[model samples]
Target chain A: MFHIYCPYCEEHREEEEFHPKGQAHIARPEEPEACSDEEWGDYLFFRDNPRGIHHELWVHAVGCRKFFNITRHTVSYAILETYKMGELPRFTAEFPEGSLSEKVTTEAEAMSRQEGVKA
Target chain B: MSNLVAQNIRTFETHPGVEISAESPLVFFHQRSGAPAPCTESRVALRERALLGHLILRGGAIVLDEAVHSVLGFGLPAYPNALSRDEGGERSIQWLSPDEWLLIVPGGEEFGLEGKLREALGDAHYAIVNVSGGQTLLELEGEAARELLMKSTPYDVHPDNFPVGKGVTTVFAKANLILRRPTETRWELVLRRSFADYLYRWILDAGEAYAIGVEV
Candidate 1:
């Protein structure tokens, strides 16, 4: 079984504690009404099945119960990296080593998204 | 249900009066399967810390932490998957996620605690959900307790990996529960009421070799 690393939990947990949530970084159109039918449909249904490097969304269902992104090799089945939501992936298709300019998610900025929001 | 409304949230006491009785999820299991009493040769002992007030706090940890610290007189666990306990050890807070923490206290204190936390958090982006009736805590102790846990969960239970004061929600015998090491000799399993029977049986079966006992 794959011992996947959960970005939120900050530890590697058993695969049974997690579930793959399809492709990652699929942003919802900022204004849905302005989008064309094809754009909306593609956003709703289409997903990439890249054979090489792929970024996927996954939830640590049983552990932290948090959603995070995972960059993995689809063919080799090796996990390249795990990152929390709202943060960009380092080992994308182009930059295998990592990108120099990545947004540093601070504790305050992360908490700002939660302000005034009731859960 | 109490008509007390705090911060537009309805609050009620699960334990209102002495007339209404409370039972652990294992009550049925004990009736059907029968809990074997601990003997001199028993190397494992199981005890249910039933009806503890369990709260799931969600939001920015900083806001929740301050509220919790003010209300409970203790702050949230400093790191992920860590457990922080009160001086008496009767109360604990476990870091479940970056934005979430699980607070467990004495059985009847939940209602009051929720009110205090809500009062402290006024308009802050936070949620304090009292999930007291949904789950229960089972504690395992003795020599073979680690062996019983090893058979059930894939997570490394060695002291090096899971030291004292660390708690994690993890898979156990096909089910998921909060696994915690509160102290060196004790391991706490916070099981959902729905999964308690199956896990109880699984623990009993796995611990049979070491002669496990149940303290009803």
Candidate 2:
């Protein structure tokens, strides 16, 4: 049983409270009618199955019921970091050192979590 | 923003008139499975505070806070997983998420309160849902209440981790409910109407060793 940290709830909750929603950062085409058959098909059916650092969407279904992102290592099955939606992750495929970074969140960064929401 | 959006939404009383009898979700279960009366030797006590007004408030915290404070006389819980209560302790606002809070008030006050809140919030983008009929609040009080919870849930319920005013929605047995510590010796369980019977039985079974008693 893994203790997954929910970004919105700001606490580590039991993994049973969450549901993993496949891949993260899948953007829908702005003009689906203008897309080619292959482009539309790729958008609808294609997904990356990376072996290393992977970012996925997950929802704290039982707790907060909010969707967030999780950066995890497929091989190690170690969660790198959990961040709110619309926030750029510090751990990515290019740079995956988030687990070692200080957990300190500055006031500015903390305040920025609601950048997309109506304040 | 006053009076702008009130007409856009239709609100009504949830309490079916006084003529029609309203039975709690557990009425049938309690009848079928009689509860053990509390005795001096009982170490755990379970009581249901049924049919209370439950509202799910969603919006920007600041906007909701001002309106809630004005209407309910208490602001929303400042931090996630925290529970804030009014002076009487009968009314509480629990922080469910960054943008959402759960307001539980005494029964029959929800309809009027919702209207007042809607009027106060005016045109602000927000949502207030009446969930009183959808859930029931069960309170556990006694020395072995913690032990009973420990046996049921994996969440840490130790005093150091779950002090008074801390509430969390987590897995308990095979179901999930909002578990909160309102006082030093009491813990509250907000169970969905559908899960109440199952969880009630589970709690009784898990608390059997403690000789849990039901306070009607």
My TM-score estimates for the predictions, one after another, are 0.91, 0.92
TM-score of chain A of 2: 0.81
Ten-residue region with minimum lDDT total, candidate 2 chain A: A99-108
lDDT of 2 by residue, A1-119 (tens): 57998888887888888999988878788799999999999889999999999889999999889999998899999898888877667787777765323443443256466454211
lDDT string, candidate 1, A1-119, tens digits: 66998877888888989999899888788799999999999999998888789999899899887888899999888898898777667677788776654343453256447542211
Off by over 4 Å in 1: A101-119, B1-7
Candidate 2 lDDT over residue span B158-182, tens digit each = 9999999999988998999999999
Question: Model 1: chain B TM-score vs. truth?
Answer: 0.95
The parts of candidate 2 lying over 4 Å away from their true place are A98-119, B1-6
> Interface Cα RMSD per model, in Å?
0.7, 0.8
Put down candidate 1 lDDT per residue, B52-116, tens digits, no spaces.
99999999988988988898899999899999999999999999888889999999899888888
Interface RMSD of 1: 0.7
Judged by DockQ cut-offs, is candidate 1 incorrect, acceptable, medium or high? high
